[model samples]
Target: MIQEKRSKRGALLGLAASILVLVLVIVLENTLAPTSQLFVVLKKGAVYSLVAVSMNLVNGFTGLFSLGQAGFMLLGAYTYAILTVPVSAKDTVYYLFGGSAVKFSLPDLFGGVDTPTGLILGVLLAIILGGCVAAFFAWLIGLPVLRLKSDYLAIATLGFAEIIRAIFQWQALGPITNGANMITQIPTFNNFNITDESGKVVFRLSAFFPMLIMIICVALIVMLINSSYGRAFKAIREDEIAAEAMGINLAKHKMLSFVISSFFSGVGGALFAMFANNAQAKVYTSTMTYEILLIVVIGGIGSISGSVLSTFLYVACSEWWLRGLDMGSFLGIKLGLFRNGFRMVVFSVVIMIVVLFFRQGIMGNKEITDLLKPRKKTKEVAK
Candidate 1:
C-alpha cells in the first residue's frame, strides 16, 4: 500500500509538471515571432520524439532488433497523403496520372473542408488510419520476420523497408502514389492556427498541435509499458528461453510489440509529412532508419525519457543551434574549420564521445518520473 501511494503521488506530480510545461509552451508560442527558430526546432523535435520513442518501444523495451521503421513510416506517410489530399486539388497533384485514383478526401467525407470541425476530424482520423495501415503491414511482416533473431532480423526489416520504398515509386501506382513524384498540398501543422475573417492570424497553436499529439501518444505507450504485457516483453528481451520457460507466449507478445511500435511510427511518419509539407517515397530510405537508430542509441535503448530529451537536443543542435557553424562561425567565433557541413562533423564527434563514455545512455532503463521521485530520508541518531 505504501509503495502504491508513492507511485500515485509520483504520477500526479508528473502530470502536473507536464501541464505546466505545456502552458508555458503556449505562452511562448504567442509571444515569439512566427519565424522564430524555436518553432522550427519544436515542430521537428516533436515529430522525431514520437518516432524515436516508437523505435525504442521495440528495440529497447522488447529487445527486438528490427529495422523496418522507415518502411512502416513510409506506409503511414503515403496513407495519410493519399487520404487527406483535398478533392479539388487531387487533379493538380496527380495531373500526370490524369487525377488521383481515390474519389474523396477524409475531410470532405466527414464534413465540409471549410469547417474547422471537419478539418480536425479528418486530419486526426487520417493520421490514425495511417497508423492502422502501418500496423497491419507490421502484423503481416512480423509473422515471418519475427522468427529471425538479432542482425538477421534487422537485415530482413531493412530489406522490407527498401522494397516498400521501391514499390511506392513504380509508374503503375502513379495514380495512387504519384509514382516517384512528391505528394504535396497536405494540411500541415500551421493549418491548426486560428485566423480571422480578414485572413490574419489570431492564435498560434501550430507548435501545440504536434506537442499535444506527442504527449498523448507517449503517455499511452508509457501506460502500456507499465502493464503486465510490458513486463512480458521485458522478460522476452532479457531471455527468450527463460520467458518461454515461465509460460509466457513469446510469439504473441513479440507480435504485439512490433505492431504497437509500427503503429506509432506510422503516426510519426504522418506527422513528418505534415512537418515537411510533402511526402516522397525517396524520403523514407535506409538512411532515415539509420538516423532513427542513431537517436535510439544516443538516447539509450530502453529509456523513453532519454529518447524525448535527446531528440530535442539533436534537432536543436543539427537544425538550429549549430547552423552558424555552416556559415563559418558559431557563437561569434569564426574558425577556418567552420564551414558548410562542419556542424554535422562536430555533432558526430560529440555523439561518439557520449557513446564511448556513457554506454547505457542518459537514463538507461529509467523514466523521467524516476528522477522526479524524492530521495528517501534516513533517520539520524543524536546523543
Candidate 2:
C-alpha cells in the first residue's frame, strides 16, 4: 500500500509538471514571434519527434527493422499537400498542368470561410486523409513484407520506399503530385496563429498544435505498450518460437503494429509537409529513414522519453546549435575540416561513440517512470 501510494504520487507529480511546462510553452508562443529561430527549431523538432516516435513504435517495440518510413512519409506529404492547397492557387502552383487534378481544398468544405477556425479544420482534415492514404499503402505493403524477417525485411521496405519516391517523381503523375517539382501554398501550422485587434498576437494555434498532436500520439503508443497486446508484441520480439508456443498470433500483431505505425508516420509526414511549407518527392529520402532510425536507437529502443529527448538534441545538432561547426570558421579559427558537411561527420562520430560505449543508448528499453519508481516496473511485473 505504501508503494502504491508513492506510485500514485509520482504519477500525479509527473502530470502536474507536464501541464506546467505546456503552459509555459504557450505563454512563450504568445509573447515570442512565430518566426523566432528558437520556435523554428522547436517546431521542427516536434515534427521529427513525431516521425521518430512512429518509427520507434514498429522498430523499437515490435522488433521490426522496416525501412519504409520515407515512403510512407512521402505518400502522406504528397496527399496532404495536394489536398490542402487552395483551389485558386492550384492552377498557378501547378503550371506544369492546367491545374491540379483534384482542384479543391478540404478546407473549402466550408465554402472558404477564411476564418482561423476554417483553416484549422481544413488542414486537420487533410492531414487525417493523408494518414489514411498512407495507412492504405502500408496495408498493401505489409501483407508481403511483414512475412519476411530480419535484414530481409529491411531491404524489402527500403526498396519499396525507393519505388514510392520514383513513382511520385514520374512525369505522368505530375498533374497530381507536381512531379519532380515542389508543391507550395498548402496551409501550414504557422498560418494558424491568432492575434488581437492591436495585432499583438493572442494565441499560437500551431505553435503548440504540432507538439500537442505528437504528445497525444506518443501517449497512445504508451497506452498500447502497457496493454495486453503490447505484452504479446514484446513476447514476439523476444522469441518468435516461444511466442508461437504461447498461442499468440504473430502475423496479426505484427500487421496491427505495422499499420498503426504507418498511420502515424503518415500523420507525421503531413506535419512535415506543413512544417516545411512545401512537399517534394526528393525531400523524403532514405537518409530520412536512417536518421529517424538512428534517433530511435540513440534514444534507446523502446524508450519514448529517450526518443523525445534525443529529437531536440538531434535537431539542435543537425539544424541549429551545431551549425557553427559546419562553417568555414569556428571559435575565431579557420579550419579546412570545418567546411560544409563537417558537422555531420562530428555528429556521426558522436553517435558512433555513444553506440560503442553506452550500448543501451540514453535509456535502454526503460521508461522514465522506471527511474522515478523505487523499483523497476518489469521486475515488479515478474514478481
Q: In terms of lDDT, which candidate is strongest?
A: 1
Q: C-alpha displacement of 222 in model 2, angstroms?
A: 1.0
Q: Could you tell me which residue pairs clash in candidate 2?
A: none
What value does the lDDT take at residue 38 in candidate 1?
A: 89
Clashes of each: 0, 0
lDDT of 2 by residue, 1-383 (tens): 97568656645544555556567668888787666676776778888888888888888888988999999999889999999888889888899877888867888875552676668788888888888999899999999989998899999999999999999999898889998999999888767777676776567866578777776777777668767898888888888889989999999999988888898899999999999999999988899999998888898988877887788788867887777788877778788878888889988998899889988888898766657645433221100
For candidate 1, write residues 1-383 as lDDT tens digits: 98677667756665666676578678999999989888898889888889999999999999999999999999999999999899989999999999999989998887755679878999999999999999999999999999999999999999999999999999999999999999899888988888888878899998989888888888788878878998999999999999999999999999999999999999999999999999999999998998888887888889888898888888988889899999988999989999889998988898888789988877788766666536643121000
Clash count for candidate 1 is: 0
The TM-score leader among the candidates is 1
**With candidate 2 superimposed using the best TM-score fit, by how many Å does residue 346's alpha carbon deviate from the native?**
0.5
Question: What TM-score fits each model?
Answer: 0.96, 0.91
CA displacement after TM-score superposition, residue 30 of candidate 2 (Å): 2.7
Candidate 1 wrong stretches, greater than 4 Å: 375-383
